[model samples]
Target: MFVSRLLDFQKTRYARFMNHRVPSNCRYQPTEYEHAANCATHAFWILPSILGSSILYILSDDQWETISAWIYGFGLSSLFIVSTIFHTISWKKRHLRTVEHCLHMFDRMVIYFFIAASYAPWLNLRELGPWASHMRWIIWIMASVGTVYVFFFHERSFGGRDAGAGMREQGRAAMTCFFHMVAPNGKQKAPGVSPKPQTPDSELAAPRPG
Candidate 1:
């Protein structure tokens, strides 16, 4: 009877605590790099399509001589190259994967569509005529719609705290290994496997009075 009442009390206390409100201003915000990374990811979704359109335009219209093919090729390749750099930097420093790996995967599918749209004209080397123009228009419309949803979903799934917390936890684990003479909490390992060396500051240092 006593134990049941104690359990009920604990449950109620927890419920009350959980219901407490957090201040809006206290909410965590993304770091500038993280924000930039998010913006880049969204921008990337549209870029291939945009480049492909330009390439298609140059190829389709014989009179479209203003834009150089070499310039378009160089620019298109550079955008993808820059995106790779962003992914590499984010992975190494933050250990943060982009939020929508699946959506990004989907975006890649759209990229192929754009590439095909661009390449189809040149490949057949015949006029796209009526049918091909309609297909290209359809691809553009679908890509624009998909990009909006994917970007919105990604922003909601990932936040700055996710990146910060991941790095912080790693640092904590390393600190634990360097400090305690024994395993922090877990059972001792076998004789052959040596434990990590403990640092001096973690041992026997007299605590200063508060």
Candidate 2:
């Protein structure tokens, strides 16, 4: 259905023009073409993730991050494609606004999970001194809380003023900080309080006098 419309929209010049035939909730507001463009942009991530996974799989066999990297690629690819499809559908099916809005929430719910899942292997497996052990767990904890909250408040978030957009942005920011804090970029920082002294392993790896 949507796949066909996406293809047709490209072929037909008239369909590409701006219009207001979409739902009020669609991020696709102001113009129909903008909606199509957003969907297409997200859908574009699908192929690159697939190809990236295949390439990485061929390059590394036993590395845990390699395995997780594959999972990350495929998992996020699906999230992006699904988001694109339902976002399009939510716009196209103007009459089913309520149902479509719910569908959009489900789409976002997957994203909340995927963010944690995809980051687990990469962030947790790295040698981040003391932080590696629980960084992934912290992310899962946040994701778990988010999943439950999103499901329970699915309607209110969608229907209430400033509900959907506000919560999504704030939650995304807060959850992102959890993983980013543990980034192995070698930056100094704290998780719960002041940064802990580097573990013996970090001390051993420190550069010796030149």
**TM-score: which candidate is best?**
2
lDDT of 1: 0.43
How big is the positional error of residue 85 in model 1, measured in Å on the Cα after superposition?
2.0
Which residue runs does candidate 2 get wrong by more than 4 Å?
A: 1-30, 155-210
lDDT of 1 at 42: 50
Could you give candidate 2's per-residue lDDT for residues 35-69 as a string of tens digits? 77877888888888778777766875355656667
- Please, what is the whole-model Cα lDDT of each candidate in the order they appear? 0.43, 0.63
Misplaced by over 4 Å in model 1 are 1-61, 64-75, 95-117, 120-125, 155-210
Winner by lDDT:
2
Worst lDDT window (10 residues) for model 1? Answer: 119-128
Q: Backbone clash tally for model 2?
A: 0
Report the C-alpha displacement of residue 126, candidate 1, in angstroms.
3.4
